[model samples]
Target: MASSAQPYHFGFKKSKNGELPSIAQEGFMNILQKNGSIFLGDAGQKELYLTFDNGYENGYTAKVLDVLKAKKVPAAFFVTGHFVRDQPELLRRMNDEGHIIGNHSWSHPDMTSLTPEQIRTELDKVREASARITGQQKMSFVRPPRGIFSSRVLETCKQLGYTNVFWSAAYRDWETDRQQGAGYAYQQVMSQLHPGAVILLHSVSKDNAEALSSIIDDARKQGYTFKSLDELKVKMYR
Candidate 1:
C-alpha cells in the first residue's frame, strides 16, 4: 500500500460534557485501529493508559518519574533518538522501575511523508539504541511524531513490527515557554477524564510534573485507574 498526498494527522478533539469522544472518527483513529494500532484501551473498564512523549529531556522527566514512583502508577515513555542517546540513565531507571519504554522514532519525522524504508529506519534506529539499555526488552509501541499518519504509514509500522499508539487526551503541554500553569494543566486533564482514555502527557513539562501526583490522586478518587500498555491484549498486524 502507498500513501496519498495528504497525511493522516491525529487531531485530539476533546468531547464536551466530559464524555469520551466517539471512536467513530474516520481517518485519525478509526483507520489506525482498523490497521491494528492502539489509541485507547479496555473499552469496558474505567482505565487510563498513561503515556509520555519524551523528544528531549527538559529537566522535568526525573521529577515526573519520581511522582509516578511515589504514586505507584506505571506509564509508557516514548523517546526519540536524541532522548535515547542523551538520557540513558533516565531510560534505564524507567525500565528498572517497570515502566514501558516505547519508540518515538529516531529523529521524530512525519511517517506519512516518508517511504516505508525511511519510516523503518527511523523506528529501527531508536529500537536498536533503546535495546542496549533495555536489554532484550520489547519496545512494541510507536507514537508517531506529531501524531500524524496515513493508512499506508500505519501499514508500514505494522510491517516493521510496531503497534502505532495514539492518544485520546492531550493538551499543548509540549510548548515549554507557554505552559498554561499548573492549575490549568490539572483542570485540562481532569475535565477530559474518560474511560479507556490514552492520556498523552509530555514528560518535559514542568506543569505536568507539578500536577501529576494530584492528577493520579484525584483520578483515583473519581474511580479511574491507570494501566500500562503491557496489560492490554492488542492485535498488531503485519
Candidate 2:
C-alpha cells in the first residue's frame, strides 16, 4: 500500500428518497475499500447503524443511554482519552449496558500527521484505559478525529487490528452552543435517512439527546431496523 501523507476529509452527497450517498473522492474511496474501512452498510437492506463520538462529557450521554435502553437500540461510542479519564462511570455504564466502546485516539489529534508508532501509542492508551474501566480487553473499531485520515493512517490502524469506521450520514450537530432544537436534529437526521446509513452523531449535542428516541421511533416506523456496526454487511460503490 502506498503511504500517502495527504489527508482526506470524509464527506458524502446527502441521501434523499432513500438513495445511497456518493463519495466524491475516488482515491479516498479506494483507500477506504482497500483498507476494509466502512462508511455504510448493505445498501440493499433497510438497516441503520448508530454511532457517537464522545470526545468529552457534555452531560447528555446518560440521557442518550437511557433512550437506547428504553428503545432497545445498540450503539457504538468512540471515546477519546479525555473522555475515558473524565467519565469513567459513563464508560462503565456504556459497557455494562452492552454497547460497543470504540477508540477515538488518545488526544484526538489529526492521526494522518502522526507516525505509525505515535498512532499506536494514541490508540493503545485509549484502549488500555477503556479496558481498565470497562473490562473489555479488545477495542476493534476506530474513527479518526474530525473525519480526517490518510492511507498511511488507515493502514497503520489495520496493522494494529482495527477497522476504521466512518459515517454515511451526519450533520452539524456537534456545535452544542448553536443547537436549534430537538425538532431540528430530528429533521436533519430523518431527511437524510437511507438504507445502510452509518449515522454519526455527537453525544455532546443536547438536541441529539432530546431527539434520539424520536429518531429511533421514526426510523423504525419507516421500516428501518437499527443495527450495530458488528452486524454491518459492507456494500462498495463503483
User: Which lDDT values do the candidates have, in the order given?
Assistant: 0.82, 0.93
* Winning candidate number (TM-score): 2
Candidate 1 per-residue C-alpha lDDT over 157-180 given as tens digits, one digit per residue, 9 for 90 to 100? 887778888877888899998887
What TM value does model 2 have?
Answer: 0.97
RMSD (CA, Å), each prediction: 2.8, 1.4
Q: Top model by lDDT, which number?
A: 2
TM-score of candidate 1 against the unseen true structure: 0.92
Error of 2 at 172 (Å): 0.3
lDDT of 1 at 164: 81
Model 2, 1-238: lDDT tens digits are: 5457888888888888788888855458888888999888898899999999999999999999999999999999999999999999999999999899999999999998899999999999999999998889999899999999998999999999999999988999999789999999999999999889999999999999999999999999999999888898675553
